[model samples]
Target chain A: MGIIKLCGMAGLIITGWLVGFKKSADLRFRVQRLKKLYEETEELLHRLQYEGLERDRLLLSSFSDFCLVWNGKILFNESGLTAEDAVILKEMIQKLGTGNLETEEKRLLYVLERLRQQESAAQKIAVTNGKIYQTLGTCAGIMICIFLL
Target chain B: MKEDALDAVLPFVHQSIGRVFLFLPEETKREVCELRLRRNLPVCLTLPQGIRYLFKDGTIDDRPREGVLICTAEQLEETFFLLCKRSVYAHAEELREGYLSLPNGCRAGVCGRVAPDGMVRDITSLNLRIARAVEGCADSVVSAEDGGGILIAGPPSSGKTTVLRDTVRQLSKNKRVVVIDSRGEISGGTERPLSLGVNTDVLLIRNKAKGTEMALRTMFPQTIALDETGTAEELKGVEESFHAGVQIVTTAHIGEKRELLERKITRHLLASGAISTVALLSGKIGEPPEIFSPEEL
Candidate 1:
């Protein structure tokens, strides 16, 4: 009975070791895949920003890569990226690497505001100049009438 | 950042900065910026992807496109000193100030407070304009007959130099060509000319005024090519070249063929039977080039 019990305990320990080893191998494979996906994402971002390609096909391919890595998660995750989040991630990657759209809108707004300020300043200058011109013209006309009379 | 946002924003940077900001690696950017500022060339920062876009779109060609950035007086001075080191063979005093020319025919126009001695001794400021050379543009001027003087006329940046270079290349195939490059525009030669054919010889006279006279006496060329003929003495030299049995190919800035014929000096040269053909180049570079001969217009 003792010998049989010892054999049973040994078999349990062996089974546990095999399960742990299998899990480790799976985890290693997953980590490597994730690393590859990250590198690919970086390369794609670099290429897209440097090489302006408006082709829909390339965009779709990039989107797909993001999809696989993120596992459909479109938002940030503590563990890793989710698939649905690929589109958003791809968009974010583009903005950071190239330039953000929000920043651009702000820049455009700043320019427009500046132009408005300049236009107002110009109008003020024009008004001042026009007043002087009108005064000069009126005096000249009066002088001409007096001389004629 | 969003990719769409980045894409939209990067182009503005390139437009504002006026150079390919994207494709230049970070290391290259630092080096190029230093070189540019040192040579009085302009520099700008852009996303790497934007450069790729320009390259893919054909806005930036395979050949090197020189550029300059004018931000401040200090940057301009740095660029000027660097350019002086690269191009001028003599001492700083011997070299003319306020003008910086690069190897590829791109010249920067410098403007600053001039000293009393007619030197830009102080150089308080600088305005650097980057010029680029487009090769293989001179092929259109070739005629069926070999030996005749051809006049190329155009306003600034009307692809005149591009066409002139192409014409020289074509002519260089058979004839012995000698170019008196006042600004080093025709040869597109930086250190040495890459496009000027084996038969072609170039005299880079960065300081000389009398190009035609120098070509006639010193360089025994079958054909002479030069840029910007603007004086009565230079016109006389053109006549001299004709007298010496040398075919003359030169350029001037004018509006049209009629205007060219109406000019007293041009008329004199043409009427004297020195010039046989006139090539009037119109439109910008890479567009459909329109060529007009004197007889046609």
Candidate 2:
């Protein structure tokens, strides 16, 4: 009976940790993806102006590794992202693809800065939430196990 | 005309619009010169002669067809944004010049309010001019003029660029040709399948005057070609090209030889004996070639 109860408790704790870790992993991926997008955009803009690469090819290739947006359709890397962030990110990318070079550069800098702030803030929230959810999950499992006993 | 060249713009449009557009009769596609988009207005296809409204269902309403589904603000925005590749910021040079040059060498002219800092905003209309590189039509020009700096004059859409493009190709057979393409229309780009001939070097710059100087100093070619040499600065560039011992083959937006001497700009270029021979294209574009070359006045 005691062995069975211990097995049940272990299962609960493992399930809880897995769920919490998955959530935090998604948050980290999103932040990394956003940062990659920012760096790629800056590099791509330079290639466009100095190298005269075609815009469509540059945009499509810049994010091919991330697979974030394809042919105007947004493909989010992490399932955890909200619909709103995806939409906003698409808009920023679209804006980057059009306009005069100077204005575009300025606009992209603004977007990169905005993305940076979001990344930082998201990182903080992710860290906090990850800690909270993980602890809450483990504690709940222990409480449930005690109750069963 | 390259069929796939149309693909550069197909992705941004509504499926209905593209389907209907692609379904256009071959004759319609052949003659289509411009596509106009106005917010709250029906999208239109401009032929050389008349305007036809394009319907979503792949049917065109000839001029008399009154009621049609007009373009929405959202559709216009999407199309414009797509044409700019979702970034109007990169085309700042074109935006300030009031047009965007697509990859296929087509030009989209945009109209909108200018922000305080000169940024274009609230674009309400986009006019796309489909430019193609047609080769054989200019063969007659090369055969017509023996080696000399030639100038072509005609009214708007008079195939001036067409003549220039073909003439450049023909001239490029043996001569090293450098084209100062202020707009992408002349040769599209060095990479485009649209051949300006292998011996040709193209400088796709925005300012014709500056481009002329750049070509003269660096390209080191036997001939320098450009389109629409109208401005005073452009005329100066013409003299510079002539003085450099490089033949300047270019076009002007004018009708007759007399008008060439009458217009202050053309007159200066001609009076200086800068333009050796002038080929005037009279017949409508796409019609059999009828060039009237009046000896330099």
Candidate 3:
């Protein structure tokens, strides 16, 4: 009976650990997607400035996995962005093709700066909170198991 | 082309305004020459007969005070952005040129504050000119194998471009025809390429002069057709093509036959011997054009 109970407790602890790890992984993946978005936006700016490619050509050619472009607008999917981050990104994209080269370059530079800061902040959160969540889940499970005993 | 002419421009307006277009009667839609949107004013459609204000219910009014559909400032701004295809930077050249040559050969004339760099800002109004392909419209004035050049003359909105489009389409059937469609009005756009002809080669360069020169050198076209040949530079290109023995078919804006000599470009155009036949369109849309030799003017 004791062995069976211990095995059940072990399973609970493992489940808790997996749940915590998944959350942390999601946060990490969000950061990676943000980085990708930043790179794609930079490429877009470069093409607009030098190549003068049209909107249809540019949107059709965008290869980002995080963005879904339809009917001349970009929709972010599973972007792991905060409300504020998403709003900022959207504002920049809404005006993406609506300015001259110099204006667009300036606008993109400002957005890139903001994205870099967000990425940095997200990295810091993932480092600190990720470990905390995993430890908390394991500690909570162990305490419950001890109490049951 | 008439059935879808207005439909082609619907995507470029705000959703509310575009929806109104959807409910518009088919007969009215077919005759709509221009769709005008102004800030804080009733949306208007310029038909063949006269300008009519549009309402939200898809009905139109001859009076502005009626419960007409109003084009708000925000709507105009959004419409302008859409017309630019959400990429103002990409359309900077066209915006600077004061118009946008849209898909399906539709054209939008933009009016707004001018930035020093020539880009328009804070757009206040837009005139969306619907493009229609009137097949056989040019049949009366032109033949595919006609020897010398033909120049179409008309007032604004007098179907000069329409006739020229058909002329090119007709000529391309038998001749090695190249259209210097700098504005994309003649051959429509890439999204839905207008049927110029199976043999027509369309060059979308903005500079008619450069486009003509390049077409002459590389395309080896038997006939080169262009629109809005209003400048000496374009005339020079037409003259060059003439010297190469490549026929030049083009258009010019002239209110009357006498004005052909009054305008310096038209005078040079007629005297250059580059153009032999001139087709003068009545200000009316579908009326047959008056064909004349250069001597008649």
Best candidate (score: lDDT): 3
Ranking by DockQ: 3, 2, 1
> Model 2 scores what on Cα lDDT?
0.74
The local distance difference test score of each candidate is: 0.51, 0.74, 0.85
lDDT for B255 (candidate 3): 89
**Candidate 1, superposed: residue stretches over 4 Å from native:** A1-149, B1-70, B86-97, B121-135, B144-146, B206-211, B287-297
Instruction: Tell me the tens digit of each residue's lDDT in model 2 across B1-297.
Output: 647455555665555456667666777776777778888888888776778888755567775355554777888888877776665556666777788776666778889897665666798998887777777887766776756678888887778887888889988899999988876888775445367888999888888999989888887988999998889999998898888788889888887657877899878877665676777777375664555444536
Per-residue CA lDDT of candidate 1, range B1-297, in tens?
312212222222224333444554444332221112222333432222222112321233223344334335554444444444321222133234555554445444455555554445444433333333345455556753347888787766566666677677778888888888876656755553447667788887753347667767777888887776667777777778888998888777877667787887777767767777777766443554455545565
lDDT of 3 at A148: 77
Q: Mark the regions of model 3 whose C-alpha exceeds 4 Å error after superposition.
A: A5-20, A51-60, A71-74, B143-146
Provide the TM-score, chain A, model 1.
0.36
Instruction: Assess candidate 2 and give its TM-score to the true structure.
Output: 0.80
Error of 1 at A43 (Å): 55
Candidate 2 regions exceeding 4 Å error are A1-67, A79-91, A94-149, B1-15, B55-62, B67-69, B114-120, B286-296
Taking all chains together, the TM-score of candidate 3 against the true structure is 0.91
Across residues B1-297, which tens digit of lDDT does each residue of candidate 3 receive?
434878878988999899887788888888899999999989999988899999888998788875799999999999998888777887888889899888889999999999999999998889999998889999988753258999899999999888998888888778999999888998897778888988889998889999999999999999999999988899999999999999989999888889999999989988999888888898885688888888876
Q: Chain B, candidate 3: TM?
A: 0.97
